[model samples]
Target chain A: MKAVVVGAGFAGSLIAKVLGDNGFRVTVLEAGTETGHDEAVHRFRTALVKSPLAPYRTTVAAPSSDYLINTGPFAYSSPYLRMNGGTGTVWTGITPRMHPEDFRTADLGRGRNWPISYDDLEPYYRAAEWEIGVAADADEQRQHVPVADGYAYPMHALPRTYLDHAVASVVDGQRIDGRELLITGTPQARNGVPVSGYRPDGHLCAGYASCVPVCPENAKYTPRRTQKRWSPHIELRTRCVVNRLHADEFGRVTKVSYQRYEDDTTGRHTRHEVEADVVVLAAHAIENAKLLLMSGLANSSDQVGRNLMDHPALLTWALMPQPIGPFRGPGSTTSIDAFRAGPERATRAPFRIELGNWGWGWSAGSPDSDTAEFVAAGLRGYALRKAVADRVGRQFTLQFEIEQEADPANRVTLSEDRDALGNPRPSIHYGLSDYVKDGLLAAKRVSDQLFELLKADDYTSYKPDEERYFEHNGEPLRYWGAGHSGGTHVMGASKHDSVVDQWQRCWDHPNLYAVGCGSMPSLGTSNPSLTMAALALRTADHLVSHRAEEVRCTMSKAP
Target chain B: MDAFVELSAELTGFSAEELRSTGLVEQYAELAQDATDAELIQLWYTGVWRGQIPSARAYAEGLAWKAVGVAPPGTGAPGFGSWEHRPRRSV
Candidate 1:
């Protein structure tokens, strides 16, 4: 069978691997550039880019002119990764699964739920963790609350660092409303304690913090890493921007038209055509939806790009009277779900905090540095001693993963503007919902209390005036895109509401599957990546089982 | 930092309108407007502006102040020493 996978990122990459392993002739059409050693080094040099960089669809308040980037009838997101390996090439891997509540979010007093339940995805998540080579620690391992039957995580957990180890004494074993709420070291895709044997996944590692910018040590697994491990039957092509996907009369995707950027130029002379029996649109999220809309191939429900969502990142940091190697570890540390499933501890709302691994003010012109300098200047000439002392340990960053209620107005549609190939680029039309804004407020309330509990001076900036300068009339809201795009082309049991079935196959074109966050209708407390990876594997499994019939049953009764 | 800003002005040699058209103009202006990116960009801008560059430690610390917020000395809630955080597992 001939299958076409359009992305080399988490899902696309993995789908290619599984199909190649199953002995199918697979052709992966990646929208990104090269993924070999030299190209990886070059990208590391220049594309150490931003914390999040992609063509997003959101009404982002322009800091300069107050012009919002995301606005309109569709979801505006800054969600694209034009590299061979996809977003995994730029992610800091902290793998926390969506809670059980996340599976039934719509029923549990929130947005819609996935077509499949936590039980349905639990096994796939296990395979993903193993395939991704994640490491967990003691309490972290136990905290996963495993739902996978007869299977645990493939790799052992990494050790809790000094900071987590110390905090565990204070927080863990603490009672939460009469029930013990334990916060443990989180599972990470990076390496920690050494394991002797090699992983079947791909590559080896030496515990490098280079998860975001391409892994210099080759330890972290980008999808490209595994795609290479497959047999020659699988053909991998990079720099191939898939402009449109065309289908036969039977609703089967038959032809894919893409262009390759030769070099030092942005022209359309390098277009190519390939035919496939099955088409898997794994182009991350945004681009896939854009392609679907551009092609008009599988959008029978007219819901190609709606329900945009992302983990609104309310990033806050703190300074310890100590020194954290700041640059030592991965870009994220431990995580807390204490506030995830339901209302967090002592608060009546839901959210989660992942420890960021960046330093207080590593970047040159960030406000974080200004704040640090302000604090240091207050201390005057004593800076020398303070700097040395503070350099030894770590400062903590709190990354709040706030849940966003899916709004149809927040969507992705074709823009009048075209790319280098004359294909219409995606325009993001996104706005924050009161649900998320309220969630942010709830998170703030929790942050204020937590800082009080920690007894650290709360240095977070809260400027009412800033809101006046930032608020927009749409939704009459005062927030910007978290830059984490999702939802567009959601997976659900209802054909009326979603474009894809639970297996991420197009409702109209069963052979057309979209793997990525574009299929998500809800934002869970954890980062969307781990869930995306799990969903990718689940979709792959569905394809492997040849169970197209089951995909029809959950068309309206999402678990 | 001031010196670097001047140097960037010199390097451009172009008029204001020219710089305004570039994405860097928007990105930089946005950085200046952003409490976080502003500090980081300004430090890096030192090279483009006047030219002297600081160490990574100095650069990171400069951004952190604005990125993280602390109660001004005392909000009566708590002092600086007792804050708590859970560390993630080592990579």
Candidate 2:
């Protein structure tokens, strides 16, 4: 059987590799061009902003900017890179598992509950961890995340930075609400202690301190790496944008038509069609919803592009009373899960506090801004030396990504604006609800207390003039996107409320499946990539089993 | 120009031709802003290759100061301890 995957990102890459290994011919169509690690590194070195998305789109060509078109009261400032590896290429590499309480959000009186439970996805999560080469101590993780028995992570946890050790010392064993606070090492995709004898240029976190735009040392795992293992079996077609998906009278996806860009600069392209037995849409949350809505294929439930969700984060930065050291390790080495779940979540949103080791890189430009300020003050000689040392050493930042309830109003819809290939751009309408605002206030309270405990001077720059700013307890607070997109084409028990089934199969189309964060009914406090990977792997197993049953029934009919 | 290309080729494992193909010469020149590519590459060879950066923060601070024409002390030359301190190709 032939399988057509319409993305080359995290989910698409994993699903395609699994299907190829299962003896099905897999063809992946990527909308972006194939770029290597060298090009990404070159762009990163020269970038002015140093934002995660900055390096990927250095050229202002039409095809480069065709990916996202934001129209909103709140700007979607999070950079979404369109490349062979997808947004995973620019990810911060934090790989925390969703808590067990996350799956039963509705049962616990929080957000909507997922169709599948944590137990159902536990084995698949283990498989994903091994496949992606996650570096984490399973024992340590069990204290923070819920882990099943007989499942150990691929490698030992990464070494905690000085900043991490400092924060953990203060927060460890401390009780918040009802549960004890644990600041443990973050499970990351970046190399720490490699389990797979696979050595690349970027083998381990050499403390590049730049995991956002690109990891200089190829230590991080991207879907693009899997293409090497599954190449002979899987065929990847870059610059092939699958715009239209066709279904037959039986409501099964028969074929898909795509536009292939020959030259990105001139907007030149050729149209092609391909037939497949099974079609999977593994585009990121926004793009997956946009593609389905544009194709008009799986909208029988009218819930395809509704209920968009993201882990909306409130950024808080501060200065340590003493030089604890910053701007040394990865983007974030550890986080506090004290506020992830509790009795308080019933009236407010739950949250995870991510402690950044890269200092004020999330808020103010660290090292760069800190140094510039010293220079601008006209301080030179030994006085300048002492001041720069003091400021840079004490820099620290804390980011709280609060879980937002899936709301139908915040969604992705096709706009009148068309890209180079005439495909409608994804127009988004996203906003924060009172549920998230309450969570923000709770997170703020924790931040205030943590500053006092750590003896860190809070330097939170909450400007009152910004459009996205909101007054919380007389203090202006602003929310930022955590780049964890979810809930656009959510999955549920039936077609009445959701677009996909528990197995991520489209309820309207038998052979059609929509995978990725888009299928998540509700996003938990942790990053969504790990959960998305588990779901995709589970869907891959289901498809192989379903195909086996089909072959068995066909043999019986041969008589 | 030839000396800079030769030194970069020796240090970064990339041949002079390969460095040219990546357009690093042009990029390095642009980053140096006013300084020639030769001066910038020489600076990297002396500071980064010789291991002069005290810390990651120092490296970033040095680069930021250099952008505005201020050079941090204890440097051999103008380009030493700049942002383009790492080997052209880390891989």
Candidate 3:
């Protein structure tokens, strides 16, 4: 059996590995060049603005279509990589499983419900945690989501930063909006304690605060780790952009067409096609939708590129009364797990409050801006040095990743603009619904109360001219994309309402699967990477089992 | 070079020896001809000269991390569980 997986991201790499291990030939096609760990770290260090895409090089031939032309009221400014490892290379490595209630959000009269329940995915979730080498305490994590009773992560949980300790000291038992606030160590995929029998591949966490753009020590999980463990049957072709998929009248994917680029500098490329028994689209949510829309496949329900969603985050930063040692560890070591679920979600979106360890870097340009301000204020020498230390050391931020309900109006469509390969770019139309806006309002109210409880100086400010800025209830507000994009190719029970089935296989095509966060019906407050990995593992198992069944039928026919 | 280092010391509140210890004084002095007083100070603190970082070494040696009493992110491997305790220079 032969399989062609598009996009060498976490999902694609894992699926390719499983297929290769099962005696199937797998060809993994990636649109971008492979970036080495040292190269990425160097790029991040030299970058002027340390955005997520800073580490990876963007090629014209395989352009990261992150600069989407917006046709909606608000700008969808979330950027994703199109490199060999995909956006997984630049993730924060925080992995939290969705709550059981997250599968049935429609029951709360909000987002759509998932066709499969959490019980069906719980085992796979554990498998993904082991695959990704997640370092977390299953005992503590079960408080938020249901983890299997005896299951524990591959490694011990990452230590909470001093800032987290300080915050918990004051606000651990406080009640806001009738919900008790508890600061817990978030489950992260970065390496931690060294266990005897279950050692992760990479080195332990070395306290690099640059996990978003790059992890210098390779302590965080990336698809590159899985790619390193692939069997000889798997072939990875970088800089090959898959443009379309060809399906026969029987709705079986027969051909995968792509353009192989020579290099990024020259816009030179050659077209090629490969035949496969199965084709998997493991590209990021937007890219998968774009490919399906371009190929005119998997759109029987007119839902291939509709129902776009993202965890639109609202950030609130403040200065603590004393120094709490910000920017010392990972990007975030702890989160307020109180508001992730409740009865309030019926009227507004639920949110996960990630306690930022990197200080006000996301809110306002930090140590650099602090130096500039001190210089401008006529402070020089020792006074300037002392001021920056006092101020920046006390800096902290609360990132509220509010769950966005899927809306058909927020979508990705083919743009008129063409890339270097003459392929149409992804045009986005995104907006926040009233329910999400109410979520933002509720999050701000909670932030105010928390600030009061901690006696911290609130420095949160939203400008009117910001890109994602909007007016809600006569107050200016803004949101930043958490880079958790989903719902472009949603999964459902009925073929009339969704593009893919519960197995992430296309409803219209038997041999085609579009796996990733794109197949999620509703994104709960948790990060979607772990869930996407679980679904990919499940799909791989399904494909392997079905292939066995086919072999058995062939043998019986021969007899 | 000495004059540039002296000016940087006055603006950054660092002594001449400390500024020279970073080993970026000569490189920064060469780039300081086109910079304003504030930009020069920012260059020492941020390792950013005219919008671009000179090198990875420059970023790691940035004075801002020293001012805040922490190593620059992605450099100076602080080892596992180092963030749990208070920094030596906590205010």
Candidate 4:
């Protein structure tokens, strides 16, 4: 059987690997050009602002940033790279699994419950861990989340930096809101010690402080690694954007139309078509919804591009009494998971406290910008030197990824705005509900108390006029995006309310599978990549088995 | 140079020996010949990630912000002036 997969990110690459391994002829379409490791490293080294999207910009495979138009009050701060490796190449590589209770949000009266539970995705999560080389101690994970017995991580957790050890020693076992705040190693997808030298373009993490912007050491697991593993069985095409899907009389997706761009400019492109027995839309949540809406397919419920969700992050930074060295290890190596799930979640959202090792890099630029300001101010000699050392050494930041519920009003729709390719830009409307605001307030209270405990001087503040700031309890609060986007094409048990089923198969089209984070009915307090990979793998398994049965039935009916 | 080394070691909690290994001392010695206290602080951190600074731990202390010739937070210093000349970045 012939299968066509769109988007070569984490979900698409893994699904293609599975389908190819299952004896299906696979053709993977990637919108961006194939970005090699050395080029990315060179770009990162030469970039001025070392953001996550830095390495892939200005090149032929640049991200779709220049074309996007935001019409919402809260700008979509999360910028996505449209390269072959996709956003996975630039992620922080932290891979915390969703708590089992996260799957039961609706049952617990917090948010909508997933059609499938954590248990349903458990095996696939383990499979993804091995494939991605997750470094975590399963026993340590059991303290706050559920882990199956004998389900050890593929590699040992990366060593905590001296700063992490200091913070953990001070804050671990401290009670906050009736739960103890223990700083533990966050499960990460970066390479640690190898499991029997089974290296597939993988290397042990060497504490590169700029994991989000780029892993110069190539230690982080990107989808390019997945592509390498399955290259023998999969036919991969680069710079080909899947534009639309065509359905047969039986309401099954039979073919896909695409535009192959000659250059990075979206307008200069050639149109092409490919026929397939199975068509999978594994693009990111927003892009998947945009394509489906443009094709006029799989929107029978009028809910294709509704219910967008992201981990709206509220940031706090400070100077400690004693310097806990920052900007050494991964972007973040430890997190406080106390507030991830609990009874308090019903009224206010739950959050995870991610301690930044990059020292206010996300909020304010790091050592370079901080030092540059002093230089630009005309400070000279020892006085200037001392000022630079003091600020750079004492810097630290805390990021609270506060959860947002799936509000249908906060959605993605086709805008009147069009890109160079004449495709409509994704029109998004996003706002913070009182539930999320209360969570931010609670997180702020906890942060204030924690800083006091550590004797850290608080330097955190926000602009009053910022659109992200909201008046709550007569106090203004602010937030930013954590770059996690989901819920655009929500899945559910029924066709009336959702776009896909639990397996991510479109309800309106039999042969269409709209995989990726788009199918997530609700996002638990975890990064959506691992969960999306698990779901995509499960979908691939479902397709292969079901397709085999159909083929067998046809053969039996034939002479 | 010796005074800066001792101060950085005290603030960063790293010994002077470890600090010297980062090879920042070479740059420090060069800057010390002519650099003012504020300039010394600024130059050290500017080279922190580039392997000019001894260690990441020492860089985080940011004691230079309290040093002379630096403008107060937010306020730009008038060529080698104090923080009073510059607006504060935070309270």
Best candidate, TM-score-wise?
3
Identify the leading candidate in terms of DockQ: 3
Expressed as tens digits, the lDDT of each residue in B24-78 for candidate 2 is 4543444445543333433332122122332232233343222222222211122
- Candidate 4 global lDDT: 0.74
Q: How high is the DockQ of candidate 2?
A: 0.06
What is each candidate's DockQ, to 2 decimals? 0.05, 0.06, 0.77, 0.07
Clash totals for all models, in order?
Answer: 84, 3, 1, 49
Model 4, C-alpha of A370: deviation from truth (Å): 3.0
Give the chain B TM-score for each candidate.
0.22, 0.32, 0.91, 0.36
Residue-by-residue lDDT tens digits, candidate 2, A55-117 = 674222224323566666565655566678898888877888988888888877455788888
Each prediction's Cα lDDT score?
Answer: 0.58, 0.73, 0.89, 0.74
TM-score order, best first, reads: 3, 4, 2, 1
Best by lDDT: 3
Q: What is the C-alpha RMSD of each candidate to the true structure, in Å?
A: 10.3, 8.0, 1.9, 8.2
* Candidate 4 similarity to native, TM-score: 0.85
Which regions of candidate 1 are displaced past 4 Å? A35-69, A72-79, A137-139, A147-150, A173-181, A194-210, A321-325, A343-349, A361-394, A462-484, A547-559, B1-91
The DockQ-based order of candidates, best leading, equals: 3, 4, 2, 1
Error of 1 at A1 (Å): 1.1
- Where is model 3 more than 4 Å wrong at Cα? A549-559
Model 3: per-residue Cα lDDT over B1-91, one tens digit each: 8888888899888889989999888888887888888888889999998888998878998888888888787887787889999867832
lDDT of 3 at A85: 92
